[model samples]
Target: MKKIIFFHLLNDYSGSPKVLLQVIEAVAKKGFEAELYVGGGAEGGFLSSAPCVQKRYFYKRFENKYLTLLSYSLSQLILFIKLLRYRHASAIFYVNTLLPFGAALAGRVLGIQVIYHIHETSIRPRPLKLFLRWMVERCSSENIFVSHFLAKAESFTNIESRVIYNSIPQNMVSSGANHVYPYASGNKFNVLMICSLKAYKGVNEFVRIADLLSGQQDIEFNLVLGASDSEVDDFFSSVTLPDNLTIISRCKDVIPYYQRASVLLSLSKPEEWVETFGLTILEALSFGVPCIVPPVGGPVELVSEDKEGYLIDSNRVEDIAAKLAFLHKNPEVCFRLSEAARVKSLSFSVDNFESDVIEVFNGV
Candidate 1:
């Protein structure tokens, strides 16, 4: 059988890593042997336990952008030597992100096919984007994007490209009764924000919104960070949190939070960063929880304004507060949006994602 080697950039259980796991599972079901070549981190996280993963390899860190060209050259040289033993095997290199410039080079040198799966819409410095485009044009046999937003951003007009929307596994999708609104039972309405503590992710906006709505005793704000306790503490040292606001440093599983949330917020700053695709928004949708995202980037594609969720001006605290207040006041409208969100989420299923991936591999 043919061997498919995936070059992953991170060991964290984030969007890209989860996509890698899904791709590996998809390829395996198609009767191909799969292996993962991870960069930088240690061998524990979400990818370690994949039943479809035949073997795993950890390479030296190549994260510094200042030395990207040098790092790419060295990493490619190493990969070329390592893959020499599998030269005769029917194999392909599946590059998870643009960071692993080595995978394309190694595949080109080894006379193997390379598929570049792009999940980033924001690639800083025009030169880096140009370099990535040049590499993809020269090395990769196929390019797959997670959304049309990213595909359009890449502008790889000549290369063979496909936009395969990211998906969550059926088993992983949240199911059961949606959370009851606060006004109905004198309970606190839960407004949840689950994201990394980054400036571009609008962590400050979330805090600001929480402060703006602190006067409402019935509404409770919750923040689940992807950062450590100390990191969050250092970041939020100056900012004051309201009495109704609660912070959780991190969570191995976000399902419980999803189940508990009345509404999810992805107030990412469009000017600072372009979200390739908001996986958490979709996750919230699967749980019948509507989201409020900025009307930019991939989240725009996922949400329907005032239907599945609202796309508000994330910069204005008052605008966000209004939307939250609207949802809180109109429980019937909130319930309708919740049902609409679940319906919208059905289109992004793991089976569909896998099938699309398999078609790409088969075509290659």
Candidate 2:
């Protein structure tokens, strides 16, 4: 059997890792032996024990700065040596992120086919972006982008790449009962913002929006941070949270919160970083919750104006507040949007993603 070596940057169960897991499963189902090489560690939290992962290897991830050159050199040497052993095994190198410079280099040295799956945009430092562009254009056999937005933004010259949107697993979507508006149940209209507690994710803006709507007694704001308690405490200590706001520290399962939410906020600011694709928006939409996304990045592609959700100026807290208020006051409009959101999410299903990935692998 042919072997497929997958290289991923992180061990955590984030968007890219989740997509990698699904790809591994798809590759295995197609009778290819799939092995995962994590840059962090072999025991990658939940991903280490994922089914169909025939083997796992660990290597140090490359850092962008010049100071880590020595360590980067050593890591690349080790990775190259390891990959050399698989040279005669019909192995193909599949890099999951743009930062796996060493893996792409090793694949090139070994004369192996390299497929780079790009999950990020907004790469910083001109030199670094230039280096990545060179690598992808010169070394990679195929380039797969997670969104059309990312493909359009790519700076590579004369390079053609495939645009495959990220997908939501079917089982993750809540089924059976229709989503009920929070106000319909005589409960406070709940607005949710779920993402990493990074500044780019607009956590501060979420807090500001919560403060903006604090005067309303019948509305509640919930911010679910994918951060540790210490991080949450440190961040919250510097900001003042309104009484109407609640902060939840990292949840393994966010389906319950999604079920309870009347509106989902993807208020990521453009200056910080343009989202390559917003998985959270689709997750919320799958649960029949309308999303309010900024007019920047890939999230805008997922939301239709006044259809699935509204695109607002995420920089202005009042604009976001007004949109939330509109939803709260107009249940009939919210219901229509919620139903449309769910219907839209059906196009980005895991089955479609798997099929696309398998076809890519076969062509390669």
Candidate with best TM-score: 2
Clashes of 2: 0
Clashing pairs in 2: none
Which candidate's lDDT is highest? 1
lDDT per residue (tens digit) for residues 1-364 in model 1: 5678888755665678878888887887778778877755464556766656544344453346657656555655665566677667788888988877767877887798988999986677868777877888888878999889889987576678889999886666634234432223337678999887788888899988999898999888888887678878988899888887898875668877777788999988888788889989988888888889888889988998989888886798799888899888888887898888888988898778989999987775
- Model 1's lDDT to the true fold? 0.79
Residue-level lDDT tens digits of model 2 in 173-198: 43412555443334778899888777
Where model 1 places Cα greater than 4 Å from the true spot, the runs are 52-81, 174-186
Q: Give the worst 10-residue stretch by lDDT in candidate 2.
A: 176-185
lDDT of each: 0.79, 0.78
Model 1: lDDT of residue 107: 83
